[model samples]
Target: MIEPSDGAPPDSGMTLVEVLVAMGLFGVLASILLGLGLSTQAVTEDTRDRTGVNEEARIAMERIAREVRQSAGLDSVTLPGTPAGHTSTSFTFWTDFNNDGARTNTASDPEVMTYEWDPDTEELSMTAVTGLATVTRPVLAATVTSFVVEPRSSRWQYDQVGGACSCADGITTWRELDNSAVGNYNSEPDPQELRFADLLFVSMTVEDGNGTQTYSTQIDLRNRS
Candidate 1:
């Protein structure tokens, strides 16, 4: 058919411009995919951080609840409200935290426990003295922003005598135990009249670099009573 036309048929192949356009579209899609992947990674990291903070708070709060429910001698619940030479800002306490309400004097069973937070360092440290037993537990590794312990006593009375605590002198300032606070149970006139079946309130707050979290619990101290 008339020697092959010098110019090839019209629709044989795409022009260079068309190919370039297709390549550009593919690149755009790839860029979108990359952006989505980065976003997902960031979300996962944030969730992990929040979960870790919650677990730490939960562990510490649970430990405290268990010990409190089994608290035998509320009278001996020594909370260091002020540091030795410090003012009312310093609050610490030593009480029976074991499942058994018995106080341990020897290294085997430590009955006395102390919880304190250093305002300057923000460190929450725990010291326990059982019968021949000594154990120190840390509540937080970093600087603690806040720490508070309110006893849920059935009796509104607090021992407000200005004298040195049994553990150490040079430290005075005690309040009569009371249960007026909600989630607390110091409303009972006589502790002996109250049973272990009674309910008590517990609240706590903890903070880290990221943020702060609070824990509230109601427990029956009969087992520890």
Candidate 2:
């Protein structure tokens, strides 16, 4: 047994081993907290990127679809030039601006709307041609990788009254108007046939810092009877 002398001071401070152990525990806790904070920040950033990309795609697709649905027909002549066997990265259509059931070609009646994608600038733009002299252009979306519009037509034969023939005797299949070629529709000999598109397939791809996202939707023409 060890007895302290009357004059010796009592031990009041921690030993070196105790201090070292405390410091090691503190270091471990600090490392764990830092890792958690980093992980949370990374997750938040990823979520923000995804949300931004999705919103961009949604807005563009919705705008196109809304206009297509309200349109009375397509305008093939307004599209830009493209090589043979390739689809034009642009689309143009006519809508009854006055909301009349029938299409009117006047400046204030039926409006021509054109959507063009610029590959060099990665921008999707829209142009509105109301009359021979009035034109307005706006950028619809940015950071666009690709924009494609495919028009499909019904193969069913129609009678003189504009009603489809008997299904059993007439063709009932729906066929691609441009034969799966982008610019073929615009180059068709009869411009009148381009007046209506039974179904419009809108597809767009957008890229951001996070990655690329594609959005697609089908729009049925209201006045395509």
Candidate 3:
């Protein structure tokens, strides 16, 4: 080895101080990289979970809409909305699965269907009733937050030939009647009221550890003015 004129010692390996400083810097860089990696993983997992929740909610809504679109008319819509009645997390209607489109809910052929969403169980269930046998089954097991059923009903429009309002049958405007904020309908509606229910509105919400998704749609009944 060659030394400078004023050099006291020759070149050597790294000193203890240099080694310690290098190690500290390396440790900090490792920690930062690890933190960034963990954060990215967390975000990816959250996105996946949220997407799953949205899909589940969508499927459920579609199933309900499909059945309701083929329904004859509304039978019973639970409380806390129009057609007020005792509070129940369920709605009953006449399914036109049979050949006839009769809006009847008798215990004869299991044509009557009821959809119930129990908040306590966080699940949706369906019950079909008939004189012979009554069948009940689970529709889906989801974290449902709310399941609301609303009726789109209407009354006939009277004569407007001379700006005169007539209750007598002339021509059907097919406009919904605004009797009250809640309407003059309720559970166990009369035959006329049942016929008035031309549309069924359903809204649902699903909430899980991931997030919440709301789905709503209005389905038309078979009845036409």
Best-matching candidate per TM-score: 3
Q: Which ten residues in a row have the lowest lDDT in candidate 3?
A: 172-181
lDDT of 2 at 98: 79
TM of each candidate vs. truth: 0.56, 0.65, 0.69
Q: Tens-digit lDDT track for model 3 on 1-225?
A: 567789677768899999999999999999999999999999998888778778877887787777777776666665443345444567777676676756444566676788988766777788988665677887755677787776665333422222345344433221223232233423344344445667667888887555677788877775433
Model 1 per-residue lDDT at 77: 30
Q: Model 2, range 1-225, lDDT digits (tens) per residue?
A: 465878687777999999999999999999999999999999899888878778867987888788888776666632234335543477777777676665455655546777887767778877766556555554543488887666554543321122243234432212233333322444442244454356667788888556788889988877643
CA RMSD (A), model 2:
7.3
* Clashes, model 1: 39
**Predicted candidate 1 versus true structure: per-residue lDDT over 98-184, tens digit per residue:** 544445555655556666666666677777764555677777654456665444433323233222443423211123223222223
Question: In model 2, what lDDT does residue 180 have?
Answer: 32
| Ranking of all candidate structures by their TM-score, best first | 3, 2, 1
TM-score, model 3 to reference: 0.69
